[model samples]
Target chain A: MSTSPTARRGNAVGDAWVIARRSLKHIRRQPEMLTDATIQPIMFVLLFAYVFGGAISVPQGGSYKEFLLGGIFAQTIVFGCFGIAIGLATDRSTGAIDRFRTLPIARSAVLTGRALAAVLIGLLPIILMSAAGLVVGWRTHTGVLDVLGGYALMVLFQFAMTWVGILMGSLLSTPQAVQGVAFTVLFPITFLASTFVPVDTLPGVLRTFAEWNPTTSLSGALRAQFGNPDVVAGTSDAWPLQHPVLYTVIWALTIIAICAPLAVRAFNRATGD
Target chain B: MAIEATGLVKRFGDMTAVAGVDLAVKAGSVTAVLGPNGAGKTTMVRMLTTLSQPDTGTITVAGFDVVADPTEVRRRIGYAAQDATVDELLTGRENLIMIGELHHLGRVRAKERAAVLLTQFSLDDAAERVVGKYSGGMRRRLDLAATLVATPEVLFLDEPTTGLDPRARNELWEVLDTLVDSGVTILLTTQYLEEAERLADHILVVDHGRIIASGSARELKRRIGGEQIRAVLRDRSRADDALRLISEATGGEAAFDADADAVVVATAGGAAAVAAVAGALAEAGIEVDELALRAATLDEVFLELTGHSADAAIEEPV
Candidate 1:
């Protein structure tokens, strides 16, 4: 009956894994829960690659279709945040969090399990979008390690986005509100960045904001690592773009550092009432 | 004591949900908190379960201070909220097992416990079906079973059978009876007087976030006075005579219900008073078709204590 501190920590991790498995079970029972992370992103890839590829120009002899892959991947991964937010909000409204809170498990395990599940599910869209990109004549000309690094960066960004999702979810009271606010905020943040177009092509104010945006750094880093086209020859001179990998890593770490604690606090406040 | 709280208070902005309440539940006893909606039953349960902090008060559950050692309290207690809290997408078995695992039971133990609970609650037939497909009663049983996954010594149930049918409610009562017999201390909040009467070893009647009365079911009924001896005559002509005879025999004033052709008298003497009245009526050659002694209902006791019925409390706006 006696438990050491390490044993308790191990139990918390195990509990988190059990909760993550429950989320996976939900996906199994209702595969359509994954449409946002899979079908929607694939649709976006196809729509942009075929419909808008001719109008958009790629720099440094890069094909527009190949250049579009990085942006699409970045935008899709960031959108994964919306899924996590909505899921947590639903759990809150349904009194699931109340049940979880009463258990002896560590409090952080609930959010950790949710974030882990989001990351696991988030990988689907990345893979599906890459497949869709390949079908549309997009190819990664980088070495194997570079391509793997590009994906690792995308997954890391997804993990950071999960914390943001948890923070927003804990702050919001209901699933409907979470969806409404997340879409309103995320749409502009993703679209205004260099996700669908070069930052320089945007208006002056937007260009400045887009250059500093985390989504822009994520896409720029993927483009660099995957050896896709630099977004625009002159726009690439920005400090974030010049050191895209470092900037993206910093953004990811800063988001986790800031939002993780905020999310735990928000969760406690939301459920305490 | 398995659960104890003194001057527990909780507020949401300007409104007080629980206003200076006190409670103590002995080990291996079922203590029922009886109140209508907005009576702060849920708030009190939440604080005791360590789901919410009390605004101003002290609470201890299973020998652990709720505020100072909430994790220790959580480890010793199980709570089944008013809402069914089960994951709808998961099967009944999975929901039970998931809760078991979260309680730190390993996978094998969790599965074994889930199976035992499934059969114990008679949910084995529906074990593999998703909770969304289960009926209301089945969902409630599963929710109760989920809380029992760790075989907690103390159980907190908030309006456990609020929306169940009479049959389902009876079934739940049976399950609770078994748990109480097995020495699990239960502190449940309910609006059903009969539920408290049937299951509670001690009943605390709450009104406006305050404990209005506390005692066993019989003691509560006695607070409003004991049984009422009601006698019905075959002829209305003898109503006055019957009332007079009953008053003289029982030494209590008797009221005649003209519509029902019956004379009613309240008495603390219970069956002896009824016997006295019947003897007097027979000696007077009074023709009586029916005679009965009825104890005061909990509703009347509640009304007498609060100056309002439990029904009226239900109608108050949240």
Candidate 2:
């Protein structure tokens, strides 16, 4: 009741934080919502490290366990997009977004809040996977600064993916549909990249596609920063793998720049206030 | 006028939801948009609330144009949609505080306002409980409370009691009455004629994307004549004679209802008309099963205006 006319113009940062706090409350009320991000990533780490680590070999003298850690970290962060998509879609279907749209707040604050919460939530899987990686004898030979830089890049990539999630969520009408579409589109993209296997082992068309996949740059950057050897020497001679850190940063920024505007526009149409 | 809308038209694909409607609501009065399903009541409310834009029209709410300055309009009005719009995961207090914060109320003020609203809506007991655990009436009260977080000058409720039980419906009506008494102009939509009669200062009957009738509740009843003199015949064979006698006594045309085996005539004179008809029927030896005189209801008025019963209006498509 004390809202001033100037304040009604919107405090994007404060409003977005308020919106983010709401999402955090949801996580507190229903811990099961975090299951896919936490337990699932840990399960993936254990399965691949114990089951597939023995057979697969890094092209260089590096341990496959160390090589696999970078890939797992990259895959887990990208999958965080699934949570964002489903949460936004659910908000839309439940009329939460409709109520928010009528409020005297910036339209972008709603998505900003969801995006921020997804990034915060994304941190859990990264930390959990890192712990699982250490348990599986995955050690980083690089210095402390490089390790921090690597995690920072991974978080940035997750932030970029959040925009993609928002776009998908805004376009889809139902939470179930968002989950279905996110799985269908993201599954092939994650697997086709160098996340689980060496790009050289992929057949002709997939190998060429993997060489250019953003996930390839993300995983390669993490591996290089962690001082883990590349999976295949001949296959990853491309510009993205050659300067993985720079390429990863560029890919993340580009995805955010393109997806952010499209997502906002789609949100306006979807909520329609 | 607190709200002025002229030639509002909205169309969805092949269907016209609102077709060239106009309205002028005073600064402090309750106006009910009375209609059945698909009568464009929801669409009209949506447009005025700035939740949806009209295909072509001009609407101003609380002195600001809905399209040109939606932010200003939104700042001045509150809307509780048909679908309850509270976050089920958050507690009722949390939902209200969140909305208050979104409206740019400072953190302290937001919390203070949330407390005030919870108590006002009689939701203080359920304030800390998650909305998902609350019953239908509690959630609806919370949703309405959420809209009042900023203390809006005008309130728009779209079918506020569509699915509530009779008891809960009456409770909500009392809450709305208190809000109106506080000088907040209200525009509510309802399918129930009784609801409109009880709550509305002025009623607009909408059918098939158009306003079919508009007047005060009493004036609308007067349009169909003051009161109805209804009589059930003892024998269906004498329905014609009973109808003729009732019409002669009341000096009004009387019609026979085969379904009820009754003759009903509309008359300005209330008890006197009923007595005269009874005497005439007795003189003709036309036995009567029952007789009564009652004020003309909005239901009868709707039937006379639209050539269809109010209940039948529910099944029509928008």
Provide per-model DockQ scores.
0.53, 0.49
Q: Which stretches of candidate 2 lie over 4 Å from their true place?
A: A1-9, B231-246, B253-264, B268-293, B313-318
lDDT of 2 by residue, B147-168 (tens): 8888887889888887788888
Model 1 over residues B1-318: C-alpha lDDT tens digits? Answer: 888899999998998999999888898899999988888899889999999999999998888899998777777788999988999999999999898888777778889999999999999999999999998899999999998998887899999998888998999899888887888899998988988998899999988889989999999998879679899899889888888889998999999998999998889888898889988988989988899988899988888887877877655654
Residue A49, model 2, lDDT: 90
What's the TM-score of each model vs. the native? Answer: 0.94, 0.91
Q: Which candidate is the best by TM-score?
A: 1
Which sections of candidate 1 miss by over 4 Å?
A: A1-10, B315-318
All candidates: CA RMSD (Å):
2.7, 3.4
Candidate 1 Cα deviation (angstroms), residue A249: 1.9
Residue-level lDDT of model 2, residues A54-134, one tens digit each, is 888777667888888888888877777888888899999987887887787777789999999999988988999999989
